[model samples]
Target: MRLIRWLVPVLIWLAGCLVVGRAADGAEVMLPEKFQRLLPLHEPLGKPGPFDWLAHHPEPGQTFGQYVASRPVVPDRRRRTIYVQPLGEFTEAQQRIVELAGRYLRIYFDLPAEVRPAMPLKLIPASARRRHPEWGMEQVLTGYVLEKILWPRLPRDAGAYLAFTPTDLWPGEGWNFVFGQASLRQRVGVWSIYRFGDPDRDDETFRLCLKRTIKTAAHETAHMFSMLHCIQFRCAMNGSNHLAESDRRPLWLCPHCLAKLCWATKADPEKRFRDLAAFCTEQGFDEEAEFFRKSLAAIQGRR
Candidate 1:
């Protein structure tokens, strides 16, 4: 069962690689010079650590040109809004993280982000619920929530419909748990805050939880846009097999991935960096704020 769970993602990734290769024609559009300039700032992915995601599932990396040629999904005028749905209960601190995450998504994607009223966990039937045999913790079926619950409720104007839950999630019988799951074609996704730690514990913990939540929010949403897992750099879109690997990932997209986002959303690179920088500054993410500031400077030809 565990082997099957792992093989599914591997097979999907291999199939995507084939699609990307076949789609790579001379029709690939060139990214702007400003975006090209930032490429050097990012480091190419190195050897995977012992427990890294790459070690388990090697992925053929996608380039900016190939991404364009692949005809990846992008937001259209008809689907301009990004809707965030709250599932189940959340602590006061967790609720704050959700609100902040929504705000970050708005700035990140340059789209209108709305959080609908909370939906009760009671909506998940007993058949879809389980208690971990070893950990003894409650779990819910991620596939059930994503396909049955979120997909049906997806809004007409939603470029992406994301569900933020406070409970733990398992993809199916084999997997123990997953931080999140998404349907790239269906444009719907769900993520759990269960392993992000208690934000209410302390200021530091709150910030940590907020950061994790935001990263997952942005990363998963990118998937909805049909962006594949990044392998070019230490990017937000990089796949992570565990919490530590996820923690090691940057909170910002690298140049290649950024170009895809900019092209898809028609966002101005400089303005996008400035907006992200300002948000990070306001949220007391000094290091991240500094990085965005540098990115903005680079895009403006000042650095």
Candidate 2:
């Protein structure tokens, strides 16, 4: 079954090549045509299941064209860096995850991604802190972190100012907790590692936690660039109602969302895939590395 899951994308890539032929020199065709050839390599999203995110949110998804038409935020010369602000306390292992996440963001967006000096969580006032009535877990207000803490400190050269905390977060009074939250226009966001599991537990758990943290970090930062939740494919940009749904999402973007990232950040598709593959390989994300390798091969007309 796992083999089949892996082979399906390869088969799709082959079929896409037949449908959209390569040039005489085996180079990919021109701009949009080259991009179009890659689209069918990704599977279209099917109907949402009972507990799926779309079953609840029902978003009208954005396409690459729509994304461009929307005049989505893109990094410019004056605002080109992505900043990661560490909030509260992190274990040594947890801090490693944060550092890796920053590295991933750099390659993911083809931008400078740096972690600022750690900021004290005491900055979040007592009024913004609470204990979950049912679970008794300590929680911090997501809004306060974004608006009060991060927004004010957003650097002039920052394309996105992101905060990562070891603390749990609740969006407001109604919600139980959020894995993360971002302001679409403000270019600032916050995510919690509290729910991603303990990195010190075991190797498997460590990788799992690292993967989840990077996913949320990259996903939320993409939002700051004005990319909407993906509904077209099994992509990293897909909305998630819970951990199971989130875990089901791919670590790589589908072609459509990839185009958005490329367009917004002026990233070279081939180089982006290569860099991501290298990072995943170094970090022991074998499956994700394989997928990125395939993406690089597909784009380079090697398969």
Instruction: Give the winner by lDDT.
Output: 1
Candidate 1 C-alpha lDDT tens digits along 43-162: 877889999999998998776777777787899999979988989999999899999999999999998899888999999999999999999999999989987899888899999999
Q: How does each model score on TM-score?
A: 0.90, 0.88
Instruction: Give the Cα RMSD of candidate 2.
Output: 10.5
After superposing candidate 1, which stretches have Cα over 4 Å from the reference? 1-23, 26-29
Estimate, for each residue in 74-147, the C-alpha lDDT of model 2 and write its tens digit: 99999989999999988999999999999999999999999998998898899999999999999999999988
Give candidate 2 misplaced runs (Cα > 4 Å): 1-31
Q: State the displacement of the C-alpha of residue 160, model 2, in Å, after optimal TM-score superposition.
A: 0.5
User: Please, what is the whole-model Cα lDDT of each candidate in the order they appear?
Assistant: 0.88, 0.87
In candidate 1, position 252 carries an lDDT of 89
Clashing residue pairs, candidate 2?
A: none
Each model's Cα RMSD = 11.6, 10.5
For candidate 2, the lDDT comes to 0.87
Question: Candidate 1 deviates by what RMSD?
Answer: 11.6
